[model samples]
Structure formats: structure tokens, C-alpha cells
Target chain A: MRAAMKDGARGASMTPRGIAAPVLGGWSAASEGVPANVRTISLQAVKIRMRSVGNIQKITKAMKMVAASRLKGAQTKCEKSRAMVNPFVRLLGDTPGAETEQTLVVPVSSDKGLCGGINTAVVKYSQVLNAMTPGVTYNVIGDKARAQLTRMMPQQINNVIVDTTKQPLTFATASAIADQVVARNAPKTHIVYNRFASAISFKPSVATLMSNEELEKAAEEGVNEFDSYEIEGPDRSEFLLDLSEFKAGVMMYNAMLENNTSELGSRMQSMENSSKNASEMLAKLTLLYNRTRQAAITTELIEIISGASSLESKE
Target chain B: MSRAMMRLARRVVGKNASVPVRGASTQSRASIETFMKNFEQHKTSPTMEHPATSSTFASTPVTEDVKGTPEKMKLNFYLPHDAPFDKTEVDMVLVPATTGDFGVLPGHVPTVSQLRPGVVSVHVSDKDVQRYFVSGGFCFVHADSTTDICAVEAVPVEQLDPEAVKKGLAEHQAKFANAKDDVEKAHAQIGIDCCNAMVSAIEGK
Candidate 1:
């Protein structure tokens, strides 16, 4: 019984090592590299890989910092501009109007690249809208969006606006587009762009431009409840018109800002992932190089010993 | 008095004594002594007479000509979103360009200048003494005397502590002291220079 107990304890202790050896052996095999000329060659390759990975890490870190800074500025601009548009939106609600003849769709995007699926997502949503409402024209802003739209819906895109990188998209730009849309006799306009949800996430948002109908509905729903006030004649009409245009412009601009921020963040995350993958690849390469070098050294040792023993036997 | 004069005359005649005035009269020497006594009295007085003394001068009247001067200037400062609006009248806006400081005043010819990280001094109007510091941005001065400052970042000298700026400078200096590369040194120097300028501006020297 005592012997049996001792045997059981020994088995228990050996079990972990028995289980661990196969895993370690498999890892070593997976890490093994092709046999090469010199041990230092493998070592040097690993060192180079490590250095490259280090460089990638540095670049990713820098990109992250830049994205963070842009995100901060974008958030502040979006919030403030959104607040300014609230009153204008209310004025739109107070206006009395009906559906007009034509509708225009303005799709906002970035002139640059690196935001993963941001441009693609906006373009897809625009296509869906276009399908829903046939004969709706597109005013494309940003080179990437233009390119995508031109490829997918060549006839749908009416005009393309070039790079807008100097400052945050403003009401002035929106007004210019709005004027063009109005010239085309389009009574309604819609803005499509990415809405920044957080530092890491953003979603595509669509806002109606020409209809105070939604705003009116919102007001009726007590969405913008305040103390009762009165508005009169041409003053009220003029105010509503100006307010609607301004509100539409501000909303579009805010969307652009959010989209810009999302672009930066998405690019940053993608770059970070790339950097991480590069590191993992480098680590695997380094392990392989080390194993190959060790295996070469062991084989050489065995060969040298065998030759010495053969020489000794001959002597 | 005559005996004192005689003793002076005898002392002047000593072997090491300089030559005495032969043509001049004794009356002139007495007059010189009297003048010396008056000069000493003047030196001992609490105040001296001068033409440009503030007390002796009259304050200049504020003229309507100065008031009606058609100087139209606009000043805008770049600050954080939540920063309180501290109303300060600016006369001249000094922006830090890549090359050096670019100063602009009323009726400054329209120009756009590239900006860098440095202290931007906006000399307050009326009071030639007060100055505000801006960190970085471009300044656009229009022909209409509208000065627009679009800065990446700005902070008032009054808001920043001198000691903290000094410490920041010290750290930057230490970082660049043993730097092996030009890029590292340049970046570190930029921080050091900015912090040093902030400290100097805060001290108001």
C-alpha cells in the first residue's frame, strides 16, 4: 500500500511535465527554421526583423498621437457647432411649408485615405438611398468619395468638390453646395456622412435638408418645448428661411467634422493593428531563427564528436 | 581769517607744493572759496533744480485729435473651448514665424505668415505695458485693419506659473544635453525655447 501511494504521488508530479513536454516540443517544431550556412546569419535575420518591428511600433505610436489630437479638436468643434444649430433647427420647425419638386443628396467624405470602411460605408448608404429614390442627384465632396461614387454611380453624381483640408468644413462650403443644388431646381437636399460615436467608433448618419416637416414633428412631440412665444409676418418667414438654410449648412458641416475625426481614428486603429501583426510576425521569425541556429550548432557538435571518435579508433 | 590765509600761503610755499597762481588776485581766491561753500550747500540740499522735473512740468491735456484718430483694429485670441473670455485690448499683434517674430499694428499691410511654436505677444492698447502670450498659430492681417489670429494653441502668461515653466525648460535642456542626433536636439530645443519664453514673459521683464 505504501509503495502504491508513493507510485501515485510520483505519477501526479510527472503528469504536468508529461503534458508540458509535448506542447513545448510542438512549439519548438513550429519555431524551427530552414538550415542555413552560418548561425550568425539566422541571428542577424532575427535582429533585423526585431529592428523593423521596433520601427513599426514607433510609427504606430506617432500616428496614434496625431489621431488623438485631431479627435480632441474634432469633438470640440462638433459639439459647439451642434449646439449653435439647435436654435436654427427649432426655427425650421416653426416654419410652415410643404414638399417641393426635386431632392438632392450631398455625400461628404475625406480627400485622403486610411479610415477603414468609412468612405465605403458612406458610399454604400448613399447607393441604398439612391435606389430608394430614383433620379436623386449626388454632390460629392472629398476625392475619395468622388472616386467611389464615380465608379459605382457615374450618372448619379452631379458635381464633385475637391480637397477640403485647410480647415474644418464650414457653413460657407455647405452654402456653396446648397446654392448649386437650389440652382438645379432641387427643392430638397440631404446630407450623408459618418457620425463620430466615440474615439474608436463612428456610424453613418443621414439628415434631411429641405424639410422642416421632421423638425415640426419633433416640436409637436415636445422635443423642443420652451416658454410660449409669438412670431409675426415677413420677419417670421425670413427668419424661418434663413434659419433653415443655416441649420442645414451647420448640420452638414458638423457631420463633416465628425467624419473627419472618425477617419483619423479608424486609420490610427488600422495602423496599430498592422504594427501589432508586424510584431507578431517578427517574434515568430526570431524564434524560428533561434531554433535553426541551435539545431545547426547541435548537428555540428555531433558531427565533430563522431569524426574525433573515428580518428581515435584509426589511431 | 587773515591768519588762516597766511597759513595757507605758507603751506603753498613748502618744498613739495605745486606752483601757486602769481597773476590772480587774492580777491579772486576768496571769491572761489565763497563759490565752493555755495556748491557744498547746494549738494547738501534735499532737492536740486532741473528743467525736466515732473513736478515742475504740467500734465498734457487729452486732445480730441487723439480720440478721433480713425484707427480700426480687431483682436482675436485662440484659446480652449471652456476658457473664460478675458477681455484684453490689443494694439500690436506679434506672431512667432518660422524665421522670427512678425509684428503687426494698425493699418498693417495685408499678409499671411507661417507660424511656429513660440511666444506671441499682443501689446495691450492704451496701456503700452501689458502683453499676452500665444503658443502657436497663423496671423492674417487684412488691409482693413482686421487682425485675425488662428492659433493651434494659446495660453496667457498670467495663467501659467513661472516655476513650472522653468522646470519644463530644465527637463527639456537635460533631454537635449546628451542627445546624439539633430532631430532629438531640435525637438527638445523647441520645448526648451517655448518654456523659457513663457517664463520670461510671465516675469514681465
Candidate 2:
């Protein structure tokens, strides 16, 4: 992914000549510093590599902190909003599943990488769902999912929305996505997302948002419960259709929130691990540096002693 | 005069934050009608004051146990950007539903109402009424006396300027008259409708 990102940036910028000069300048400076003995050069390379890794560790640590804070807010928001849909979820539960052959899959993932397995899980789940359903179309959100799914299930992907995981996912974003899904006119809509299980664990889960006909079928199955509330004015069919559309958008919003929380949680965990690895690598490199410096000093002393003995023999 | 109108028309197109789609406008129309009917159903009931205690929210499964009538309705209002109101209990809430205006009390029936661009008047008490301008969303009234209103964007009513609303209305009207295509005309129409509603809300109509 990093390689792809670098390539993408290079293509977009198209300023390789400007970037190459500074890079070559640094390389020349490094070469000028040493006589370039094989062992010394290897040691210098390790030091430079260690410094870069240390810098990366610092960046990951900061990213982890940011993700951790955002996860707290996203988790709470997702939980509260999920509560708001409880009654509707129950009402739909009684509704019979739609008999539609075609299904629309909404895979929720974030744009940023260094988050381990967040996008992969969503893509893998869609693959499973695609296999289960005969004809499946995908409406993918976020760049990460777009990249992965385009490779995994190229034929199924219909639309790809990038950069939706921008800071603060809002209701308008979800509504726009819902509009796109509605436009597709698929009878069964399934949202594949990562459910935030805990700070350390998350599992990809699927929620099915039923079509208008399916809701009516469910309402009929649970008539006693449905009749308890007085529906005011709109025709039953129209009301059901509108309700399904609205709830589907809200459901998508909730799924995005949950997926965001999981993404952050996974990012924080992965970053923490990477930072630890970096420090460990730094320690090992430092030890090698000490050992190599000592060996160089001892070799110089031996050469000096041998030169003095040859001089005494000549005298 | 036509030149001035044209200038205003250009400004209006730029000023309109979100261009409403044909489907949303039609859907809100249906919801407004239903909302009006709901308002009529509850109009005869006298307003009652209840003790105000805000509610906390969780994603727990809905309990099947029969719930006793509560004194006030618990509201959990969420906006996509940030929550304007979250799990706050209130005595009554008058929402501008897509169909019509209606109020929710502690024991209102379980129904779903889509929203249009209008004010959500939340009655926290007899004297404390908090109003918010909601840019289209949904209100779900649960059997457990919980009412949740979710929207794309919401701002406090006090924050809205009547002068701006008037200007917007004029500009949108000019655009509507001069629009060349059906799509452009429809966009201007949504702008007009929203601005008109904003004026009415600010005037306490």
C-alpha cells in the first residue's frame, strides 16, 4: 500500500527532477563522509536505517494517540445512535427476508492505511456475501476498500466513493450514500462493516436493510405488535417506502460510525506494535554500532604496533 | 431591474448550501401531510408539565417487558457532525415533519416521521423551549417513550438571521423564474421553500 501511495503521489506531482536533486545531494554527502571500506559502509547504512525507523516510530506514536481519542467519541456516538434504532430493528426482524436475487453490498472502510486488516476484513466479507447471493453489486465507500475490492471483486463493484473517512463523518455523507444506493434500485441492501467489539478486538458483521415489500411482509407477520401504534396519514405503502429509505440512511450512518471506531482502534493497536518494533530495532542497531566501532579501533592499534616492530628491525 | 435580479440569482445559486433533490422534496411533502394529521390528533390534549431528567443511551436490545407510562419523553437527538441534543428528556417536542408540523408527548404512539428543512421546537419545560433548525432528517418515536431525531445539519434557532432569509428568498425566486432547465428550476424551488420556512420560523409563525 505504501508503495502504491508513493507511486500515486509521484504520478500526481510529476516533479521527479526537483525531488531527485535533494535526494542525490544527501547521498553524496553520505558518500563524502567516509573512505567507503566495506564493513564501515555497512555500519553507516545500518545507522541511517535505524534513524529513519526511529522517526517513523515517533509518527506512529502520535497517530496512535489521535486515533485513540477519536475512537472514544466514535464509539459513544455509535452506541447511542444504535440504541435509537432498536425499535425499528425489532419491527424489521419480524419482517420476512426479501426474496430478491440481486443484492447491493455496502462495504464501509476508511481511506488511510497502517490500520491492519480493517479494509481487508470488509472486502473478504463482501466476497463471502457475493458467493452466497447469486447476483451482487457493490457500492464501496472509502479509498482503502476501493483499492482492495477493485482487485478482489472487480466485476461486482459498481461505484467507489473516496475520502469519506475525512475528519468527522456526518449525516449528509450518509444521506448521499443512501441516495446512491436507492438509485441503484436493488431489492436487498446489505451493509458489511466492522463491529466495534472492544478496544482490542473487532469483527466484521453484516446488517441487512430490507426493501419496502419486505417490511410490509414483516409488518404482516407481526401484526399484533404493529397495530399497537396508530399510524397517522400517509398511505401504508408510501409510508413504508419512505420509512425504509430513511432508516436505511440512518443505518448506514451507524455502520460508518462503528466502522470508524474499529478502524481507529485497530490503527492505535497496530501503531503501538510498530513503534515497539522500531525501538527494539533501534536498540539492536545501537549494539551493532558499538561492536563495529570497537573492532575498527582495535584493528588500527594492531597496525600501529606491527609498523613499530618493522621499524625496530630495520634499525 | 433584470440585471439586478440576475446578479442576485448568481449569488443565490452560490449561497445555497445543499441543493435538494427532487426525491427529497417529494418525500418531505408526503411526511408533512402525515404530520399535520398527527398534530390534529394531539391538539385537543392539554399540555402537561413533567419533571425533567435527561436519559443516557446504549445500543442494548429493546426490552420486551411492558413499559409503564412515563411522565416525560426521553429524546436522543443526533446530528452527523456533532450531537446538538443527546438522550435529553423533554416534556414535549414540536417537529417540522416532512408531512406537517406535529408534537410528541410522553405517551405519543410509535411512528416514524421524515423531516424537512424546519425548526424542531423542543419543550424542555413550560418556560424553557429550545429550538433548532434541522435540514431534513427523521424522527423515530418508540413505544418506550423515547423520541430520537437525527438530521444532516442543525443550528440553534437564535443563530438564524431573518435578514439573510429574506435575501435568500428573493434570490431563489429570481433564479426560479430565470432558470433554463428543469434541474436548475427544481434546485431553486428547494431553496425558495427552505428560505420561506426559515422566515416563518424566525417570525414565530
Candidate 3:
């Protein structure tokens, strides 16, 4: 009876161990063993993924560097041009002359892509402007601008100008646009673009391009009666004309510079965010892997102890 | 007429008889002649003493003496950060215009001139001049005598490093000398020559 009881106890324990061993071992093997093939495949997949991420990082880094360099140049140009235009505008404001009947708004945007949402935001602002003032016509500068305007308010677009790819946004191009506007009898031309605020911030800005009438008014106001002795010949008139064009050109050039800087800043910020997200994902995956590995090791240790105790008791 | 003459002769003869002698009459006549000469001298002296004529001639010296003091002129000047002078008394802003050199002084006619890349001289009130090198752009002088210059690019000549300019010129020259094509060589040569000239001008050589 004693032998049978001992045997029954041993059998019960053995049965429990037997049942638990396979289950625990199987779990351990499945979790920890991760079959060499599966491990190889997973590691290969990780490596591929890591390689892709690295490539993305490289591209982003390159882009960031390029944007940084370009941003510096563009910012300088933008700032200098802004300084040039402000005085001219102030001159216009101070001039006591006849106001024009029409105001033309020239919206500058990029023909290309990768500088995200800047083109879209500029277009949206234009739409808002159009809504505020009915019958307002637009002179679009880039392909993206033309595309956005065409889809939303095709009728509002009076002229679509294709960019001179060689020059891009330049004084010459601005002059051409100004000339066209002047010829069309547009009284005042305003430029709309994204002004760079920071690496992640770009605010839309609008600047006025002085018209001939404004120039004339400035000249008239600038000419004092006491000093009328200084006003000579077609020289004053010629100066006024050149001043108007130069002011307009500078305005356009500055807008382009601001837009370029803002675009690069946006891209840099976006890339930095991407890099941060990638690192976060990598950390999560590594934690998951460690947990699965630890769980497998604990199961194997428990199984080994249980097996050792059961065999020793049977002996 | 004969009766009157006879009366005159009789009066003369009675007067002659009443006279003491010819010598006494001669003495009276000599005295009369002396009195006539004195009268002529008094008339000329009185004319010379007239206050209106003499005062007009004497007033010219006072008027001429008052105008001898020189009038002084004042001018105000503002210099850029890169410029040598912090502040100067400027009489005018002289810019190198594309058409020609132009000047802006107080009470100048309102004008606008296209500026080219060159040196700008600012004439000061003290007759001293400050010079700046400006790049291409335009300048506007208001009737209020406020002159505003919009330069496409501007840098003080002093700010440019002479050594760097020389090095750049040499490099550009070498590049041109070794160019495989005429077009490339021409472009490089132009750049080299420009740098060379700029360096020389800035160094005052």
C-alpha cells in the first residue's frame, strides 16, 4: 500500500510535470528557438528595413544640408531685397498723388514639388483673397499655382506665366511680369509668397509692387516747389519709370527668396520629424524583441528544474 | 543915350576930382581884386563841404568792410557699418550712375539715376570726402533733399580683403590659362581681369 501510494504520488507529479514540460518547453522553443530559418528571415528583414531607413536618413541628411546652404543664400537675398523695397513703398505712401483704379495681385509659387504644402497654402490664401474681393484677377507664376488655381477658381486666373526654368524667380522674370501688368493697365501689383519665419514656420506675406501712377505720385510729392529748380528734363520722368520697375522687380525677387527659404525650412523640419519617428519605431521593436527573448529564457529554466526534480525523485 | 553918357562922364570926372590921387585909387582897386580872388576860393570850398555828396562817397567803405566775413555751410552725413567714418558732415551724396556720375546736394533737383558697381564719394561740410564702393542699383533723391540709394549690392572698399582678391585673381587667371575651350577661357579671363582691376583699385595701386 505504501509503495502504491508513493507510486501514485510520483505518477501524479510526473503527469503534472509531463503535461507542464511539453507545454512550457513548446512555448519556450516557439518563443526562444525562433527557428534558425525564421531568425534568419527576421534578421534579413530587419537588415533590409535598417538599410532602407539608413538610405532615407542619408537622403534626408543630404537634403537638410542642401536646404541649409540654399536657405542661407535665399535668406540674405530676401532680407536685402526687403530692405530695398520698404523704402520704395514708404516713398509711395508719402507721395501725395492720384490713386489708381485697379489693384493687381501677383501670387508667386513653385513649379516643382518636395517643398511640401507651401504651394497649397499660397493658393488657399489666394482663394480667400478672391472670395473677399469678387472679380479680382490673378497672375499665376508657377505650374503648381496654375494647377491649383485651375482646379479651384479657373475663371479668376487672368494670366498663367510659365517659369523661366533657367532663371527661376529672378528680377528679370519679375520685370517681365510687371511689364505685362503695366501693359494691361493694372494699377497696383501685389506679390504673395511664403515668408520664412524659422526652420518649421513659414508665414504668408503680401507686398505691393508700385505702379507707374504710384511712381508718378511719389515723384510729384518728392518734388518740392522751392527745389523745383532741381527738377530737370525727361530725366525725372525716366527716373520715375525705372524706379517703378526696379521696385517691382525687387519685390518679386524678394518674394522668391522668401519662398525658397521657407520651402527648405519646411523640408528640414519634416525630415527631422521623420528621423525622430524612425528612431522611436526602432526602440519599440528592440524592446519587443528583448521581452520575447527574456520570456523564452525563463520558460526554459523552469522546464530544466522541473525535469531534474522529477528524475531525481523517481531514482 | 548921349545925355546918359555925358552924365556918367561928368560923374566920373567929379569922382576923379574928389579922389585924392591916382595912387590912392590904385590902392583901392588892388584891394578889390584881392577880395574877388578870396570870393572864388570860398565858393569852391562851400561846394566841397556839402554833406550829401561827401557822405555818399564815404559810405562805400563801411558797406565794403561789412561783406568781408565768410559765410559757413553745414552738411549732415550717415555712414554704413563697413564704412570708415562713423559719422560725417556731408554736403552731398555722389553715386556712380550707369549713365554717368551724379551728385546730390541740398536743394538739388529731384532725380533718379541707375547706379553701376563703382566707388561712391560723399562730400562733407568740412570739405572732407568719404568714399564707398557700391554695386549695381538705382538711387532716388527726393525734393525734400533726402537722398535714398537702393543698391543691388554694396560693400565698403575697406571691407574687401586685398589678399583674397589677389588670390582670386590669380586662381581665375590660372583657370583661364588652362581652359580647353575658347568660351571657357574667355569667361575665366573676364572674371580674372575684373578681380585684378578691383583689387588694384581698392588697394589704391
Which candidate leads in TM-score?
2
**Candidate 3: global Cα-lDDT?**
0.55
lDDT of 1 at B93: 70
Off by over 4 Å in 2: A1-39, A51-99, A166-168, A196-200, A223-228, A310-315, B1-68, B82-87, B97-100
Q: Write the per-residue lDDT of candidate 1 for residues A1-315, one digit (tens) a residue.
A: 334323323433443334334434544554585343344554564565456556655666676677777877777776544433322332222211113345577787888765578888777666655654546788887898898889887987788877776666665675565566545545556667777767678766655555444334433544332112222122323433543554455556666776787788787787667556655655665566667568767968998999999999999
- State the displacement of the C-alpha of residue A196, model 2, in Å, after optimal TM-score superposition: 4.1
- Which regions in candidate 3 have their CA more than 4 angstroms from the true location? A1-51, A94-103, A111-117, A158-185, A197-202, A214-230, A233-239, A293-315, B1-89, B95-102, B107-120, B124-138, B143-145, B151-205
For model 1, what is the alpha-carbon lDDT of residue A238? 47
TM-score of each predicted structure versus truth: 0.48, 0.72, 0.55
DockQ each: 0.01, 0.06, 0.03
Better of 1 and 2 by DockQ: 2
Candidate 3 C-alpha lDDT tens digits along A95-147:
11123455566777876655668887777656544543334688888788888
Q: Give the total clashing residue pairs for model 3.
A: 1
Lowest summed lDDT across 10 adjacent residues in model 1 chain B is found at B49-58
Clashing pairs in 1: none
lDDT for each residue of candidate 1 in B18-82, tens digit (9 for 90 to 100): 32222222322232234223322333222211101000011121111232223536554533222
The 10-residue segment with the lowest total lDDT in model 1 chain A = A225-234
The CAPRI classification for model 1 reads as incorrect
